[model samples]
Target: MNYELRLYLDQLTAKSASIELNSTYARAIYIVEGSIAIKNGVSTRLTLSQNSALSIPESFSLGGGSADAIMLRWELVNEVDNSNKIQASQSTLLLAAKMALGDLSQYIIRCDRVDFPPEGEALTHRHLGGGIRCLLFGSIQIHTLGNIHTHQPLSAWFEAGPDAVYAATDKTLASAFARVMILPRGLIGGKTSIEYVNSEDKNKPKSQRYQIFIDELIQH
Candidate 1:
C-alpha cells in the first residue's frame, strides 16, 4: 500500500531541468501536454508525448523539452499481503482484482486520459479491471450500483471491480486521467476491456459511441 503522487506543471522547460528518482516500486509517467525524455540507464531512453503514458519497473531519470510540459507521476509498491485491504469508496471495489491476482502475479498496467465534452454523457458501461482515477480538470460524477459521487480537480478515486457506470458529473466538460493495472483476462489485444449494457443507441452518433471513446483513450 505504499504509493506516491507527484504533480509537475510547466516545470520541465529546458534540458537541464532533469530530475533523478530512485524507488523500489513501479512508476508510471503521464504526459498531460508536451513531451519528455526518460533515461533509465545507458542506451535506454524513452520519449513520451501528449495523451500518452509509460510505466517503468524501478528507478529512472526524466526531463522535459524546450517548451514547458505538464506531467503526473505515480510510484506504487506492490504489497501482496495488503492486496485484499484496498482503500476506496463503498461504490467501487478498486482492488478486488488485485487481490485475486496477487497469487498469480500476472497483470498488465495501462494508463491514459479520458475527456468528456460539455453535456457529454456515456451509456452505462463496466470495465473488466479495477483502477484508480484522478480528476485533472473540471468536475466528474460517477454512478455505480445506485451510488453517485461528484469529484473535483486534483481529487482521486478508485474504480473497484468492473461493473459500474461512469459519466460526466454535470453539464460542463470534464477530463480524468487514470492508471489501471489488471489481470490479462481484463484485456486481450485489439479487444475492448469494457462491457456496455446498452450497446445499441441509434440516437447516439458513432463518434460518441462508448466503445469508441474508450478505444481512443486506450490507443492514445
Candidate 2:
C-alpha cells in the first residue's frame, strides 16, 4: 500500500472540494489558507484556520464548507488494529499511532521538527543517521554532501541501507520542520531489529532492531 502525503498552499479560492474517508485508511487534515469547516459523520463540525489541523477516520466523511482555502490531508496506507477507535466527528492534525495502523512500530519512528529563527543555518552538524524523511510543515532546501534538493510540504525521501552520513542546512529563514521515519533495517538479521550506528557503535559492526514499531507516524 502506498501512503499519500500532500501539501496545499496559497490557494486563493475553492468552491467546495471534499473527499470521503474510507475505512481502510485514516486521514490527517491541516489548514493553511482561509477558514474551513470539516464534517465527519455527525452533526458537529470542525472549524480550522491557519496552523490548525484535524484527524479524520476512514469511516468518517470530510468535506469543505468554504471557498478558496488551502488544506493538507494524509491518508494511511495500512489497515486498522483492534486497539484503535474511529472518531466520527473531529478535525485535527494529531492522530493516535495504534488507531492509524495495527502495529506499534509507528511510535518507534523519530520525527525531527527544526525551526530556524531569523538567520537560517543557525547550526550545522554531521548526521550519521539515514531513513525516510517527509516534509510536512514549512519548506526547506537541503544541501547534503551528495546533492542539493528542495523539500516542500508532503514530500518524502528515502535512504536505503545504512552507513550514510549527511548534513542539512536550512536555506530559508522561515524555518524548516520535517518528519523523519527510521526504517526497520535489522541488525541481528531479525525482523524486529533496526540498523543504527553511532560514533560509539560504529566499530561494533552489529545492528539492533530494539522492538521498534512503525504503525503510525505524523504526516510531517
RMSD of 2: 10.5
lDDT of each: 0.53, 0.41
Question: Which residue runs does candidate 1 get wrong by more than 4 Å?
Answer: 1-13, 23-26, 80-100, 103-105, 169-178, 197-220
Q: Candidate 1's C-alpha lDDT?
A: 0.53
Error of 1 at 60 (Å): 1.3
Best by lDDT: 1
User: In lDDT terms, how accurate is model 2?
Assistant: 0.41
Q: Given candidate 2, what's the lDDT at residue 99?
A: 22
Candidate 1 TM-score, C-alpha based: 0.65
Per-residue lDDT of 18-121 in model 2, one digit per residue for the tens?
54545533344445557676666678667677545555544654445455565444444443333222232333333222122223333233333445433344
TM-score of each: 0.65, 0.49
Q: How many clashes show up in model 1? A: 3
